[model samples]
Target chain A: MSMVSLTVNSRPLRADVEPRTNLADFLRDSHDLTGTHLGCEHGVCGACTVIVDGEPVRSCITYAVACENAQVTTIEGLNDDEVAGELRAAFTREHGLQCGYCTPGMIVSARDVVLRMPDASEHEIRVAMSGNLCRCTGYVGIVRAIRSVIVERKARGAAPRADLRTALGPVGSGHAGAFAGGADKTADAPPARIASPVSRAATPRETAKLDADFVPQTSFPQSFVVAHPVDVVWDFFGRVDEVAACLPGASLVGTPTPEHVEGQIRVKVGPMVAEFQGVADISRDDARHAGRISGSGRDTRSNSATRGLIGYTLTPVEDGRATRVDVSIGYTLTGMLAQFGRSGLVQDIAGRLVSAFVQNLEARLGQGEGAPAAPVVTELNAGSLVYSVIVSRLKELWRKIAG
Target chain B: MKPVRFDYERPVEIGAALALMQDEGRVVKIIAGGQSLGPMLNMRLVQPELLVDITAIPALKRIEDTGSDLIVGACVTHADFEDRRVPDVTAGALAGVARGIAYRAVRNRGTVGGSLTHADPSADWISILSAVGARVILRSASGVREVAVEDYMLGALAADLNPGELLEAVRIPKCSASARWGYFKSCRKTGEFAHAIGAVLVDPDRGVFRAVMGATETRPILVIDRAALFGASGFSTGAAEEVAQAAGMGDLLDRRTHAVALRRAFEQADAA
Candidate 1:
């Protein structure tokens, strides 16, 4: 626990709070101020809006420890406030609420809108209150209530509080003293409940079902050229162990057979990291110089699972002196990581991951047989993450295991 | 959702924050307004061992008007710009853009530097700041370096930050009397991540006619050759098609939205 001193609802309070405890949790759980609501713990849903240093902020995302020496006010604190009082009456008259779960935050945000833009039109009021989402009333009653309050307040000769905040930094920041010696209070605090790391080999593999007719959620194409001839590159593709070594962040559980292979691949994209471990099936057609590898894996940490199918064909270029590899990857991702992985960003990360894999493959091919494999790069190149590395490794491992 | 347990340190000095970042073998993240990083942290997408809060640093909160430019501290909130709490050098360009970021509550705590350093392609600052030719000043234990906002973001969620380096301030050049700026973003709902963003700054006095096609899933595509971009009339749809193609936008709808956004921005600038 860390010692944090702040004023809550005009009352000076000091508490020993864990750094992970957000402002809403500290208010509701620690101080019995349960007026603040949490709809989505992220900043997207503004249900946790509360007054911090006279400015409203998302309490769910703002850590309590960061609000040291700051003034915070919850919905319960606004009982006697003028604007809130008027809003309460208007909301009741306009039927602005249905369930009232989002009322606390809605009122907090609505109060800010009233003070900041008193003369805001109906459209402007809607735009200003867009952050706070209400499932009921379709926002018809809510917008009406706010507009009525604004119209009445403007008629009362009230002016906009545009300059309510005069400080520079974030609303609740710049008021606290620096914690000496990093987190000194955390040292004396009891050990936190942390999730234990999942061991790779020991954990039972809840392998996803893979089949020939499996369809993918999304797919993209990627290609790269190697300086070596098609036959040489094709021969290199036959060695599954060697091929696995060429790809970054891929490792096998045991020796692979022609029909099935099992392994794991760790993919990192920016701050997110996922290690997927599972099994796959390999198939090849020599006449077409093409092959397909289909597999599925799960990242136990995020509880995200991915099933992918990669098909590759080697075609001769530069009169057989060089080889071009055409790869098509299709994948289905479902879970927490998928929720965060925007589609465009996934494609970008996959594109970069493919280029990095090609570089590693070329380097490995440059070093002839019996020579030590190129240095193992456990991390993807250029800070990339997602399906490409995982798919590419599946293709490479399938080739070696099947050969 | 609650974030993973992590140690917190509120450092009042940039040097102290940098020192915390320099701690080898520790996953350290710098938290300013905790607007962008907060969501990621709550979702467990980013789990750091220690969070170094840089908002209390007085130096990072200092804003100065250099007559020709506004050197805004990294911790300056978007609301600060929206309310003109700090001097604005871009006329109302900064304030206009600030008013549209997220919402009033988000602007209350979202820092300008935090948005830039987070480097979300859909964010407003990267598009408008790059169009305005703003330069970001980065500070580290080694020294300070200034990089153009256009070149600051390497990719999505990736800023060109060396280890221990933090963006200290943004140097936004003042708009001349003849300067005209326009920015348009396409979001299904107000304050949501924009699907397409178009920003243009045409300043004859500054000899800058820069247009940007932003929210491209990577770096924003910048076009400095106004002749090739604009025809004798104004923004040309033909040129927009080429720009969209060059940016590798394959979806026809996506390309059309970006083109229309640019066209609207051009119209807005013309009206200005």
Candidate 2:
């Protein structure tokens, strides 16, 4: 058994819950905050929608322990909300409900729709509230009711957001809390909030983000470019320290040996940054003006391992007036940064870093890093042009970089 | 419906979560969004003895932009994508896909990682991501492997997820600004699970053209080559027929319905 504390409907509550206790069961079976109905139990039915951290999420699947210290606002809390009060009236006036089984879910969803789409059209309203299903009323009445309220609110210039609750006075007080047009609101209620999962049926973490002996790493290809002439660039590349200085939010510091270059590079993935120290075996072929740099290292901070193989070719362009530097880097990232591999974000950032490094290189090359020529805002609807620009940019930046 | 008894742990880090999964005897299921598993628990379709909740692990929620792709953690919720919380590198097609999944509440809770990991063929991300040639990351105590969406999904409600391995994230390659994308789904009604899901992604310059037809049955039919998806007729009835025949989808769906959906997808991508 574990203890959990949360602010539910402006009420601070504490309870001992089972390890398997879900928020829906905790609320309904314990404190009896049954206003947040549950239809499908899965997330499909909007019946379990409740405001958690000001965002409406399905409570049916939310673990009770996960809500520790969270602020939970259920339908029961909307009694004092003026917008909800007004909407309840509109729902009744429009005959928006028939069986009333789906009323709470509808109202909760309607609240979110109004807050998000203040000037929503009829079609938009239908789409926004489509998650909540009502077998009765065919949803036409519900749609009409929500729309009328939106229109009425617009006329009054009343903000769609729920403001500080003003009292509705007594329109006939009831045994239940929800102001769903004088209904017992808790008829289908099964969830009652208990102090914890310590009741007769009651039964239910570490600080690490991952718990693997060795998290898997993904290896992918990434690229970058340089504007300097090939011979000049290759000469510049020979100077490891200068090249390392080019990367923004990154720096590689070390001495170069005849056979290899050893350096430590510090890079910030997000708030968590790591410094990778390694030795690279450099293979340079001046005859072909091509080279391969391979290295292996470990992040001093996270102890994550990293390996990279970068192959480059220097091609003369514009009749040797310019040098085209093409790079193909296949890197394997493991441990702390492996998760970032799935989204392909780390690689994208790697692309951005190269761009930043290129500008930095321009500065190092005695060429002032001018604000890159005004971006060519290719007009929309030109797919062919877009493709060309992207292709050119890849040649200019890195292969398969930005769109 | 309340879930039966089960042990639960909310691991703050991935290492701890993986270690917990390695324990023997108890059946373990990874619960990130709980949007898919929760309902199944209530309906008693699945009742695992233990649930490893990874939502609170901050690292799992991070979004990083790879040069060629925009990779988001598996825990990113649908609303995050819909609201552009992360860098939308899919030319608004990714956001559009997130927006039309279930509804606002589900979007707030249902995660993209979970959607793909669960591998519901009728689900939006499965068909759409597959159409766009996205990749999924699978990690376990053993190691990590990246599987293209096309190869990852085996059939309806089935994914190539190994036991004790969790889906890490999905890598959606950056689409060109003008790359046309069209995704169309036919449902019995609003909010209903899709019946016929068609997606078209075309970037003529890169020679990337893909067409996918989903929700017929066990697996979604796909056409990734440029010629197969965009024949001489350009996704017309005849083109769709050829694609359907090539993809073995003609027997799965009404040829007319398949043709109509294919045409809509092609036209939308062209128009957009």
Q: Highest DockQ: give the candidate number.
A: 1
**Ten residues in sequence with the least summed lDDT for candidate 1 chain A:** A381-390
Q: Write the per-residue lDDT of candidate 2 for residues B66-151, one digit (tens) a residue.
A: 68887778888877777778677767888888888887776776788888877665688888888788999888889889998866
TM-score of each: 0.93, 0.63
lDDT tens readout by residue for model 1, A1-403: 7667889989988777788889999898888898899999888878899999988899988888888889999999999988999999999999999999899999999999899887789999999999999998899999999999999988988767755667788989878778754453344564343454444467677866987788988888878889999888887777777777766778888898766788888776656677888898888787888888899998876677889999999999999989999999898888778876677777776776676677778778778877755643557633333334434543443343233
lDDT of 1: 0.83
Q: What is the interface RMSD of each candidate, in Å?
A: 7.5, 17.5
Error of 2 at A115 (Å): 0.6
Q: Model 1: residues >4 Å from true position, as ranges?
A: A182-200, A211-213, A375-378, A381-403
Q: What is the TM-score of chain A alone in each candidate?
A: 0.89, 0.42
Give the alpha carbon lDDT tens digit for every residue of B171-241 in model 1.
Answer: 98888889888999999999998999999898998898888889887777777777656778767877786
Q: Grade the docking of candidate 1.
A: acceptable
Candidate 2 per-residue lDDT over residues A325-352, each given as its tens digit: 7777666677644532332344434544
